[model samples]
Target: MPDECQPLHNINVGVLGHVDSGKTSLVAALSTKLSTAALDKHPQSKERGITLDLGFSSFTVPMPARLIAALPCRELQFTLVDCPGHASLIRTIIGGAQIIDMMLLVIDVTKGIQAQTAECLVVGEIATQHMVVVINKVDLLPAELRHKLVVKACKRLAQTFAATTFAGCPMVAVSAKPGGGDGPAPPAEGVPELIGELVKMVPAQPRLVRGPFLFSADHCFLVKGQGTVLTGTVLSGSAEVGGMVELPELRVVKKVKSMQVFRQPVSACRQGDRAGICVTQLDASTLERTLLCTPGSVPTFTSAIAAVEKVRFFSGTLPSKGRVHVSLGHCTLMAEVTYFGTPDGSGHEPAAALRLVLDRIGQLALNENVGEFDYSTDYAYQHELHGLEGRPSASGRQCQHYGPQWALLKFSQPVTAPKDALVIGSRFDTDVSKAACRLAFYGRLVALLRAEDPSELAHLRIFKLKMRAGSIDRVAPDGFSAVCKGMFKKDTDISLFAGMKVTTASGAVGTIEGSFGKSGKFKVAFPKGIVPAAPGHNSITLTFKRYIYDQNKRNMVQ
Candidate 1:
C-alpha cells in the first residue's frame, strides 16, 4: 500500500528486443540513476551482448492516484522490467509481462527489424500488450542505415501490430552507449521522459470486484532479516500488509507481513504496481514463478478452457503437433496440440491458424488470445497467436484452401465436463482430417462446421450433434458448453431445470433431470422432444432431477 500522498499509481513497463539491442543497457542506464540496483555492471552483459535474465528497477513520476488513502504521496510510481532479448526466454518474459502497461521494444539499428522482432511482435499481439519500438545502437549505424532500419522496423511493427491491439505504438531511435544520443536528443529525451510517457499510456488499475489479489512473481529471494521476498507486478486489485496470499502454482498461502517497491519498504499496492511481498511463514524455496492472490478471490482451476475462434503460429516449419507448455496468469500446464485444423489463412505469410486442446484448466474467457510454443536451440523458433481486435481475423484471402471447414477441436484429455473450453483451428492449408488426428492425439474431440449447412456440425465419428440456437452457449469456434436457463416455451416431454448438467448433444446421460426450489415449486421431468441435437432456433432446456452422484461427493465445479 502506498502512502496517502503517493497512493500507488503504479505503471509497469517491460523492455523487449533482439539480442544486442541494448535492452539491459537501457535498463542499467535508467535504473542506475533512479533505481536501487547497483547499476548491473556485469562483464558478461557487455561481453555476451544480451540480457540473460529479467531486470527490475523503479522511478517516480508526477501523476494522480485514484485512491488517496493507499498512496505514500501523490506522485505516480513506475516499475521497469528488462526482459531478455533472445527468444528462449520469451516464456519467462511473458510470465513477467502479464502486468505490464507498455512494452519498450528495442531493435538493433544495424540489423533493423529481424525475425526475433517479428516474434516479439507476435507475442505482444497475443498478450494484447501496448508497445513502443526503439531502434537502439544508432551510434553504430551509419546515417543511411539508421534511417532505413527505423523505417523498416516501423513498417514491420505496423503490419504485425495491425493484426492485434498495438497497431499504433510510438516509435523512436536511440543509442545507449556513451555519446549515443546523436546531435539532437531522442524526442522523449532522457530515460525519465520515456518513463513518463509510459506512465501516461498505462491504464489505471483494474477493478477486482471479488478476486484474490494477483501478483505475478518475477523474482524471489530470502532476505537476511525478512523471510521470503517475492517481487512481481500486481496484475489487479490491491493488497495490504497481512493479506493472505495463495500461491496456486506452489499451492501455498502465507500471510504477507511486509511489502516493498524498488527495495524500499511500503504498506500497500494496487493493480499494475510492482511489489515485493514478505511472507514470514514461507521460505524462499516455497515461492516460484506464480500468481499470489488473496485466497477467496482466486479463480478455481478447471480442466476446461475457453478460447477465441482462431489460433495462429509464426514458425514456418509448422509445429510437430504434440503437447507443449502453456503459461498464463501463474499457472503453467501441458496442453496438447491436436492438429492444425481450418485454414483461415488470410493475413500474414506461411504460418497458419491451429487447434489446440489444453489437457486441463477449462473455462477460458471469451476471445482471450493465448500463446503457443516450439523450442529450438538457435533461439529463433518463435510462435504467437493473433486476433482482429476482439475477433478472429477475417478468414482472409491468400490462404491455402484446406477444405476442412467448421473450426473444431478435441482434447487429448477429455476436459472435466462442465469446464468451459474452446476448440481452435489453424490458418494453414493442411488436410482437415490430419488436423483432427493431431487434435485427437492431443486429446480433444474434433468437429467440422459446414458453411453450407450451418445447422449441422460434423463430429469425427464419436458424436455428430446438431446446433440448437438456444440450447448451448457457443464459447468459441467449434466450442460449446452446457448452460442452465429457464425454458421460454413449455413442452410436455421436455423439462428444463437450472444448474443441471446436460450431457451429450441429446441432453441425455450426465444430465440433471430436475431442479428444486426452497418453496417446493413445480416439479418437472424430461421433455418429449429432447434429442441428441436440438433445433437451430429452439432453446436448450434442462429438467431438474434428484439424481445426486453421491451424497458426500463434491459437485464438478469444486
Candidate 2:
C-alpha cells in the first residue's frame, strides 16, 4: 500500500532509563512534532534538569511492508513517550509504560546500566513485548576505543538480558546530542538508524477496534472554549464524536464533544492510536491521570488474582501476605499478596506427587504461555517466593523459573482495572539511595474481585498440600478393614481426620472411619475384596489439601 492510500497507524514508544541518561534529548532528536507537554515543558522539570513526568512527541513515516501487509494503514506514526527516570518518580514511569507498545531503554554509554536503569528495564520486561536498547552518549567514549567498546558493551548487555524477554533485542548506538549539546557535531549521529531498526520491529498484529472504548487520559487541560482535551492513547475499542463515555472512578459520565489526532481534528479514535479527546462539563484539574470509557465497560476492583514472576535482579524475597505497591495502568495502590502455584513448577509439593508428574510449566512461563491460570487445579502454598534455583532438584528439574505462577492481591484501595492489564509489584519503601532493585515482581491481572461482589473469592482456589504416614497394624478376616497406628499423637483429635482418603504402599486405598481405642489408632475401611498386601507389613499414606485462604477449613482429596 502507498503512504496516502490508507489511514495512519500509531505506535507508542516509551523512552525509559536512569536520570541524566539524555532521554529527553533522544526524544527530541527523533520527534518531528512535540506535543504541548513534551520535552521538559514543565517548569519544575526544566529547573531540576531531569524529566519529572511523561513527555509526548511524535514523527511519521511510510508504513512498513510488514505492517501494511497485516493491516490497512498506509502511514505509521511513532509517538515517543519520554518517561522520568528518577527512582522516586517510578510510579509515573510505570503509568507511562502501560500506554506504550514498544520501549526504548536508554543507557548512558559513559555509565552502564545504573540503579534506576535496571528498574526501567524491569518495567519494560513486564509492560511491553517489544524493545530496543539505545546506547546514548557514545561520543563521550575515547574516539579511538569507541567502536570496539560499543560492540563489547552490546555483547555484555545481550548476555545480561539473555534470560529475560529483552534477550536478543535490537541495540542502537546514538549520539542524540553530540558534544553534550555544546560542540559542532550534527544534532544526532545515529537517530535515523534507530528509526530504521524500529520500523522493522513494528508489531504486525491488528489493533483492537471492536470492543467497548477505553481511553487513558495522561494529560488533561482546558482549551479556551472547546473543552478539556484528554491527551493519551486509546487503549482498546474505538470512540467517535458525540459518543457517551464514563469516568467510572469519579462517577461522572459525559459525551465526547470532539477529538483530534495531533491537532488534526478527527471523527474517531481506535486502539493503539494516540489522540486528544475533547469533553465538556469537566474540570481538567480535577481529572489528572484518569480513564474514560463506555459506561461500566471498565471495572473497579478491590482485590485481584494475578499471575506473577520474580524480577531477575530484585534482591528481596517476596513473602506470603507481604505488602507491596502494585502499579496497574494509570495508578499505583498498596496490596497484600498471597502466593501459590501448581505443584510441578516450584517443587514445593510432596515428593510423591512430584514423581507422578514431572512438569515443564516453567518452560511454558519462559516461553510466555503461562497466562489464564486454572483455578480448578490443585496448588501448593509457599512461605515465600524463593530465588532462582542454582541446580536441578532430585526430580531432574529444568532451569530455575523464579517465583510462583499465581498470587492473590488484596488492594488497600479500590482500582479500575481492565482485563489482562499488566501488574507490577514493587517495594518502593526501600531506601532510594541504595543500589538494589525495589521492583519485587511483575505479572498480569488474570482475574478480579469487584468491590461490590465479595463472593468472587470462591473462584480463586489456591490450596496447601498435606500428607501423613502410618503403619497398618492388622487386617480383619474379611480383608476389608484394618487398624492404623501412629497416624497421630495420643491426645490428637482424630475426628477431624474422619472420612479422609488414604492409600497403602501395596496399592490398597481406604478411608479413615474413626479413632480406635483412644490411642490415636484409626480404623481404615477398604472397599469390598480389597486388602493390604500383608497385615502388619504395609504402610499407609494420607494425602489431601486445604484451601489456603478459606475460613471454613474444608478438606479436599485428589
Candidate 3:
C-alpha cells in the first residue's frame, strides 16, 4: 500500500451556508450540544440566527485505523467551524473559508439554493476544491420534495459554478434533528459515505517548502484563559512555538505561546491544517484578522505603482468610474478609479490595466487578488435594475480577464505578506496587482522598485508616462536642483535655493524639496505644485508630485 497511510489524524471541515440554513443546528446534532457558556458568547450569537462571528468546536469522527497510535483512524478529530451566513459579513466567511481543507456547504432543502449559496460556493472554490454539498434541513422537507430538491440543488451548483473548477459537485442530504433512539441517525447514512469521499477527494495539505509563511487570519478573538487567539490555516510555510511573528502593517511582532490543530496542543503546525495559535503582545482590538508571519519571509510592499496594463471598474454604468474600496486580506483602502478602459476615454473595453491611487493600505502582497468592497448600494443598484442582489448581470459590464496584470498600489502604512498572491476571494476579473513598477510609484512606501535597473525604470511606461528621476544638482547650500520630463516637453530643470519660494497656480508655496533622485540621466525633485516649469529653460520639466497634482489641468502656454 502507498505510504499515504502515514497517519490519519484530524481533518478540518468548516460548515458554510446562508442565514437560517442549519449549519449551527447541523453541527449541534452531530456533536454534543453547544451552550453559551461552552463557547463563551457575548450575549449576541445564541439568540441570533446569524452566527455573530466564527463558532468553533471539536469532535471526533470514527475512522478506519489507529491515527497517531493514539486515536482510532475510524475516529478522526474534526474541527467544525460554523461561519456567519449573513450577506454583509461575507468577509468573515472568507476569513474562515481560506483555511479549510474541505467545506460542507449546508443548504436548506426547503429554501433550496440561495444567493448565499452561490456566494459561499464561489469563495469555497477559491479557498479549496474539496467540498461536500450538504442539503440540510431534510427533516423539514416533505418526502415527495426532498429528492427533487437534492437534484435541483446539484443542478444549481453545476449551473452557477460552471466557469469554476467545481462544476459538478457531489452533495449529501442530512437532517440535524435527533433520532429518538438511534442516537442521531446519520441524517443521511450517505453523510459518512460523503465523508469517506472527502478523505479521498481532498488533496493533502500543501507543504510549506518556502521561507515566508502566509497565515491568512480567519478568526481573531480573545480567549477566556489565553488572552487573544487567532486561528486560520497556514497557507504556505511552517510556523512553530517560540517563533517570532510580525504584523507588516502594525509593525509589531509577537511570540507564540502555544499552537493547536485539532484541540490537541502541538509544537509546530504546517501548511494545509487549520491551526489555532496563541500569540503574545497583541491586544484583541489590534488583531484585525491579519497574517502572523515570520519577518523577511513574506512579501512586504509599500510604494506607488504604475500598472502598464489596463484595468476595469464595475459599480454603476459602463464607464464604471468612481472611488471604490480596495480590500486584500484584512486591509481596506479607498483607491481612485482614475479612468477605465484605455485611460484615454475610449468606449472600447480595453485590456485589464488601471491606475489606482491607494488612499489606504494594510497587510497586502504583490500579484495578490484584491477586490472592491461591494457596497450595499452597489447591490441595491443591481436590485433596482435587474432584481438581482448578489448576481449582477455582466451584460455590458463583463470584466476583462487577461489573467494577472502588472500594477502598483500605494499604501498609507507599510504592509507585508509572502511574495505569493494574497487572495481575497475567487473574483479573478475583479483583482489587481502590486507589481514592482507600481510599488515604486506609490509615494512613501518602503518597497524598492524591481526596475532598480535605471534603464528598466526609464522604460517602464503606464499610459505614456515613463519612470524617470531627475538629475541632482546642488542648486544652493540648503536647496537642490532637479529636472522632470513630460511627454510633450524636454527634460526641464528646476532649482530651489534653501528657503526659496515659488508659487503655483494652485496657490501653494514650494517649501521643501523633500527629496530628489534620477532614473536615467534626468533629475527629479519633489515640489508642491501642479505644473512643469523651467522659468529659465523654455522647455519645462514637471515634478512627478506636481505632474500628478496637476494632471487634471490643461497645459500652460510656455
Which order, best to worst by lDDT?
2, 3, 1
Off by over 4 Å in 1: 1-6, 32-49, 64-73, 143-164, 179-200, 204-210, 296-302, 309-322, 337-558
Backbone clash total for model 1 is 68
Best by lDDT: 2
What is the TM-score of each predicted model, taking all chains together?
Answer: 0.57, 0.85, 0.57
**Candidate 3 local lDDT, residue 394:** 21
- Compared with the true structure, all predictions reach lDDT values of 0.48, 0.80, 0.48
lDDT of 1 by residue, 424-524 (tens): 22222334223121111111122222212322311121111122223432222322223333433333222333334444344443344442333222222
Clashes of each: 68, 0, 38
**Candidate 3: 10-residue stretch with minimal lDDT:** 378-387
Question: Model 1, residue 377: displacement in angstroms?
Answer: 44
Regions of model 3 farther than 4 Å from truth: 1-14, 30-42, 58-78, 178-190, 204-206, 217-229, 279-285, 298-321, 337-407, 410-416, 425-460, 464-558
Better of 1 and 3 by lDDT: 3
Runs in model 2 deviating more than 4 A are 1-6, 65-71, 181-186, 344-375, 386-404, 450-456, 469-496, 501-510, 525-541, 549-551, 554-558
How are the candidates ranked when ordered by TM-score, highest leading?
2, 3, 1
